[model samples]
Target: MSFVSEFRSFIAKGNVVDLAVGIIIGGAFTGIVNSLVNDVVMPVVSVVVGGIDFSNYFFPLNSAVTATTLDAAKEQGAVFAYGKFLTVIINFLILAWIIFLMVKGVNKLRAAEEKKPVEAAPAPPPADIALLSEIRDLLKNR
Candidate 1:
């Protein structure tokens, strides 16, 4: 096959299409996960922990940097931004947990499907085949 044909065939493969779709869906899912962590979960967590904003949590490396927020501190000088890192870690953990639950649920469904009992006996032969068999048996007797 020519290069163009080979390339087309590769792209047309089921796994390649599935992977492309997965990547697109994953990108959209990342946005949803980010929003959940930043808007919903973080706010609830902030309330529980007395309204502390993790994004602004950082240690200024330079003595000259006196800004409170991480962004402002970075504007002034370098800072160790552990709070942002913590938030990202939390987001990753939540996303991983959700994916794990989804996979577990799918596996359970597959197992249940597989466990369903199959038909114990095979179906009877077609009419013509049964008639042929009867004639064959009669010839053998003669």
Candidate 2:
């Protein structure tokens, strides 16, 4: 087969289809986790901690920079964004944990499926055994 045909075949394979589905699902899952962290978790954290806002949680390297919020600092052309980096790290950890749990669940289901016993077909009597039975019947007839 030509290169193009071979490539098309590879893409149409079951593993490739499964991988595409996984990527789509993973994207959707990421959106959910992002919403949870930004809306639910951050709001609660803001209420409890009272002063720690991950978005605004940055140290201004430039002493001349007098911006109250990280965004404002960035707007004024400031550098060194530790807060955004920290938030990204936290988000990555949460996403990884959720994905890990999902994979673990899938693995468990696969294992259970594999553990199911497969029934075998019954074996037929050998030709020699059949012939012996025929000979016995013939002797009885005699």
Candidate 3:
């Protein structure tokens, strides 16, 4: 086949297009999870622990990375973002918990299905026994 034809076929079937859509949705989902972790959950946590932005919470490594907080490190062109890492870790933990609950619900449904009783088919009578009963009836001369 020609290269154009193959390329056209690849585009027509839509695997690549589907992948692009999936990537876009995944990006959006990540943004939502990140916001939930950084904005909503963390603030609630901060209230309990005297209000601190964990994303801005970090330690300075050296003088090259000037400034006291994580924002300063980035301002002076520092490579470290330990606070970002912590925020990501928090997101991962929350996502993991949500996934665990979904899986647990699926398992419970599977268990309920398994617990359901299966019916057994009735047994057929033996041909020899049926024949013997017929012969006995004949002998009795009904």
Q: Who wins the lDDT comparison?
A: 1
In terms of lDDT, the poorest run of 10 residues in model 3 is: 57-66
Candidate 2 similarity to native, TM-score: 0.75
Alpha-carbon lDDT, every model = 0.94, 0.84, 0.81
Best by TM-score: 1
Mind giving the per-residue lDDT tens digits that candidate 2 earns over 4-120? 999999999999999999899989988888888887877787789885887887777777778988878887776688866766787788999987998899999999999999888
* Candidate order (TM-score): 1, 2, 3
Candidate no. 3 TM-score: 0.58
> lDDT score, residue 67, model 2?
90
Residues 24-44 of candidate 3 have per-residue lDDT tens digits of 976887888888997898888
Instruction: Tell me which residue pairs clash in candidate 1.
Output: none
TM-score versus the correct structure, for each prediction: 0.81, 0.75, 0.58
Scored by lDDT, model 1 comes in at: 0.94
lDDT of 1 by residue, 82-125 (tens): 99898999999999999999999999999999999987898899
Instruction: Judge candidate 3 at residue 134 and give its lDDT.
Output: 90
